[model samples]
Target: MSLLGDDSTESVAETVQETREVVQEEAPPKTGSTSFKLARLLFGGVLAFMAVDNFRNLEETVGYAESKGAPMAETTVPAITGSLLFGGLGIALWKLPRLAAGAVATFFVGITPVMHDFWTIDDEEQKQQQMIHFLKNLALLGGALAFLRVGEDD
Candidate 1:
């Protein structure tokens, strides 16, 4: 009976140790350059495209900004477009990513509330549309934060 008890305790300890080892072995490594590049493209591509689209339809974008009660729609629109273009390219190219992330994150923070103010909308369809855009921008903000933290030893 003593022999059986001793063997069982040892077996349990061994099993625990093996489990730990397996978990450690299976842990994912840090993101490699290839994976990081792909992530960068995914995160930055949308902003770049948006910037280009805004440039192409500058007048329409300015009008939308004006409808949202943005001051100086003409000047603000061009400035926003420039920031988006530069920030998106910087992020995608891994050039000053922290700053680029901050820019992109800032863009989302400033635009989401103003552009997608569901609380101020009367129509149900518009409210729903604004809510969706608001949520989507928040998710993008989270992604930008992650991108900012990437490469930090933390």
Candidate 2:
């Protein structure tokens, strides 16, 4: 007449209770405020937008590279690749943030030298601009990493 067998019922109940306790125990503590969440969302949104913008300007980017003395084929190819890559990365940050942040930080570190190379610029003003761009990217990378850490707490 008893369902789940008399012995199995007690064991099943115990298992259910244990599972609930474990779930509660492992649940993440609420550490982030509403403002922190909003800031994170804004940071992520801006990065996503920039990615789309970069993709939209692929052709103009190629032209800029050509003007900078890059080979025609090489310039165009990298522009397209970078556009697609950054756009994909932006989407990733929006969807799977931890992975995206890690990838972006790694990418920024890897490209920092080429991005900030003072020797590549002939004009003083251009060199200053490049430095500014380099610092901005570094800041963005830092912000992304910080966002990832904050997200993990949420």
Candidate 3:
């Protein structure tokens, strides 16, 4: 069966294979630029460092998340930390970078609202702190998105 609707003669498998070949043929030459590599390492290294901190303070992290009304905090804390660590490593090593960028983006998006609900906080100081964190996360999200578009020339 063809996925392109009626009147399509090509099967899905054939179409996919052809698309893959075209992509491979059109892929840009690897630049291996030192500055770009350094930037990736810096971005990914920060994530990995954060993951390490989370791992070291798993219980405290979970408690904080629970206080923020995160459901299943105990399980979620570790899962999130693991994602950060692995994603950071992948991006740093320039291995499957796009996928790693997605993972990093997902982590920030998932954590921001849950952990920094400034509107819900009544204390002025705490609210300000949360708002700052929220804004920082938004900036980080932008960086991750830019990373996702790193090699679109292909």
C-alpha lDDT score of every prediction, in listed order: 0.83, 0.62, 0.85
* Residue lDDT tens for model 2, 1-154: 5787889988999999999999888846343556655665666566656556655776775665555555563444454445435533553444565665665566566555554665688999989988887888789778767756744654
Best-to-worst order by lDDT is: 3, 1, 2
- In angstroms, give how far residue 98 of model 1 lies from its true place: 0.9
Best lDDT among the predictions, by candidate number: 3
Give the TM-score of each candidate. Answer: 0.76, 0.57, 0.77
Model 3 scores worst on lDDT over the 10 consecutive residues at 1-10
> On residues 1-154, what C-alpha lDDT tens digit does candidate 3 reach at each position?
5466655554666898999999888746343888878888998898889899999988899999999889899998899889889888877887877888888899999999999999999999999999999999898788788777773431
lDDT by residue for model 1 (1-154), tens:
5666988989999999999999888734355558878988977888888899999999999999899998898998888788887778877887887788878888888888988899999999999999999999899889888877762421
| Each candidate structure's count of clashing pairs | 0, 0, 0
> RMSD of each candidate?
5.3, 11.2, 7.9
The true-structure Cα RMSD of candidate 3 reads: 7.9
Residue 152's lDDT in candidate 1? 45
Model 3: CA > 4 A from native: 1-31, 151-154
Which is the better candidate, 1 or 3, if ranked by lDDT? 3
In candidate 1, list every pair of residues with a backbone clash: none
Candidate 1: RMSD over Cα atoms? 5.3
